[model samples]
Target: MNFFHGQETLSVIEWILRSVVTFFFLLFAVKVMGSRAISQLRLLDFVMALMLGNIIAHPLSDHRIGLKGSVISTIVIIILYLFGIFLNLKWTWLRNTIETMPIPLIKEGDIIYKGLKKARISIDLLLAELRKEKIADVKKVALAMWESDGKISIFLDPQYEAITPSTYQLETELFDLPRTIIKEGKIDFQALKQINKEEGWLVNELKNHHQTELNRVLLATVDYKHNLNVFLY
Candidate 1:
């Protein structure tokens, strides 16, 4: 019987061969398409991806498409995608024509109503993303932009920023990043090393906070000033 012959039941050999071919083709296609296929996916690209998946799914899941027909269709889609990628890279005009540019949502601490309407994003959603950046007051923001990926990028006014003693020529503690000491009832020895702290110091600190049992501690972190903050479970 022909390999591509209509059959109600799929043999192990047929399944294996078809799977390998489809998997490799998809892998190669994605690699060529770049991370944009998986990350920061624009709406058009997202729809195109769903269509490609539908095309490939017929042969793998349903027997509507035979191996030969599926492979050829898949190849055509991949090649067309590759040509689009080529155009995107080589032609600046084409790239701009296909992709959306960053839109300004806020300027000088004031919302640009026209821009908000053009972006098709609501004021509530914009404020939500700004709050995530630890911005309590919108007036403190100098500019807010809606990125191409639909995320907001906030720029704070210099006057509202945290004052550094050094900026005014005063003394200040050395800056450092916080390190997690414990998380989810588990001790993190690596974090202790990151803060240049010993396990004994960690144990004593835990005890000082009335948390002698590491398992009972929900979360702990060494702050920028080296102060240990413990959260109990």
Candidate 2:
């Protein structure tokens, strides 16, 4: 427990214990912050992440620095972060201020130079982002926005958009996600039960259709239509 607080010296085991505790504490903190903090790093999220990392990192490197202070500071920061998120939800102005409004970088096939300056992104960076989105020509973009999360959202002109089944009024089958019945040479009995299948039936199917033994299968999936797909080891 002394290792958790400021100590003159620490054993190898104490150091290991301290690291394990810090790792789990950080995991718990991140869990409390929610998926938004991990996925979309807005202004508030960015600040929280930066502060938490700095606070936790110091104690791990120096034995004199205590884990207790870092943990307490992290908890306080998380609470403030949650409160800030709540305020953002309750007030539109605060949300707009903290998150900021999306700046239009391109509109109607024309680049807005003012938006480029406001977003503080160069034309080369914008072109690089466009390339990542598979838009080779600027003229093909109907709208391009610089999001508050530091990501650029690009919408291609309808004429240049990829043709889909709806474009031709074509009929399509209902969506059905295949359930994994077997993985890594092991049968998922729960998945089998979900599809109203038996172990014996699956083994027999593998023998008859796939012409391979059950253990030889690396992965197997069954669709809504009971179409068994198998990949061998």
Candidate 3:
């Protein structure tokens, strides 16, 4: 029993050591490869990562890299890499779709309430992220966008006179009535009235904005100059 326990303990220690080595190796490779592998995430980068993992996984394991496994793995990685390249070239939308859009954490001097809700993030969390970028004041942020690969972009407001409404119109894209206006436990009556600028406006507006239940909106505001801000629970 003592001998058996000793052998088991040794096995566990060996496993732990192997895991540590594998982790460090991968970490080193990632560091050498740079941030683009995660940020841009091109087909080449993805395939290289998979191949790198497989290459490292083999040496760590008890099994040797046979001629067949080596050739097959290489071919599979190559095929995947080629396919990704083809997709990127053939379909621009495919690449665009795969890449995440900049999420609006804040819009037009207001912390986009609905955006945070959609992202399942909290105000404090968003503030913490902004603080990392040396941004303490929410008012200072004109456009705080969450980037493609888990990056936050804080666009500070330019120190200039506000442009004319005509300039605003030129700069903005005219959109129809908002779909989901009231969000994140807040009211957007102004937004409701704006769209339903007629009789029974409140009821119709509420219906359009899907405010059948008043308690649903966590935050709601509208800046027709840009986009409707909403946050729902």
Q: Which candidate number would show the highest TM-score if scored against the true structure? A: 2
Model 1 C-alpha lDDT per residue in residues 1-233, reported as the tens digit of each score? 33454467787897777778778888988887778778877755766688778877888876545777766776787777778878888999988888778899998989999889989999898888888999988888999988766778889999988877767898766767778889987778887787788877888887886656787888888886678888887
**Total backbone collisions for each predicted model:** 0, 0, 15
Pitting candidate 1 against candidate 2, the one with the higher TM-score is 2
* Residue range 108-226, candidate 2, lDDT tens digits: 89999999999999999999999998889999999999999999999999999999999999999999999999999999999999999999999999999999998899999999999
Candidate closest to the true structure, highest lDDT: 2
Candidate 1: misplaced stretches above 4 Å?
A: 1-6, 11-21, 162-233
Candidate 3 lDDT tens digits, 1-233: 12111132335555566566557645655565457666675446765777766765664454333223443554565566556757866997987876655689888789788888766778888889879978767888888887665567778787533566676566655655544445554445565566654335433544576555446656655454434454556
- TM-score (C-alpha, index-matched) for candidate 3: 0.45
Model 1 residue 63 distance off true place after TM-score fit, in angstroms: 1.6
Clashing pairs in 1: none
List ranges where model 2 is wrong by over 4 Å: none
The RMSD of every model to the true structure, in order and in angstroms, is: 6.2, 1.0, 21.7
Greater-lDDT candidate between 2 and 3: 2
lDDT of 2 at 32: 92
For all predicted structures, in order, the TM-scores are 0.62, 0.97, 0.45
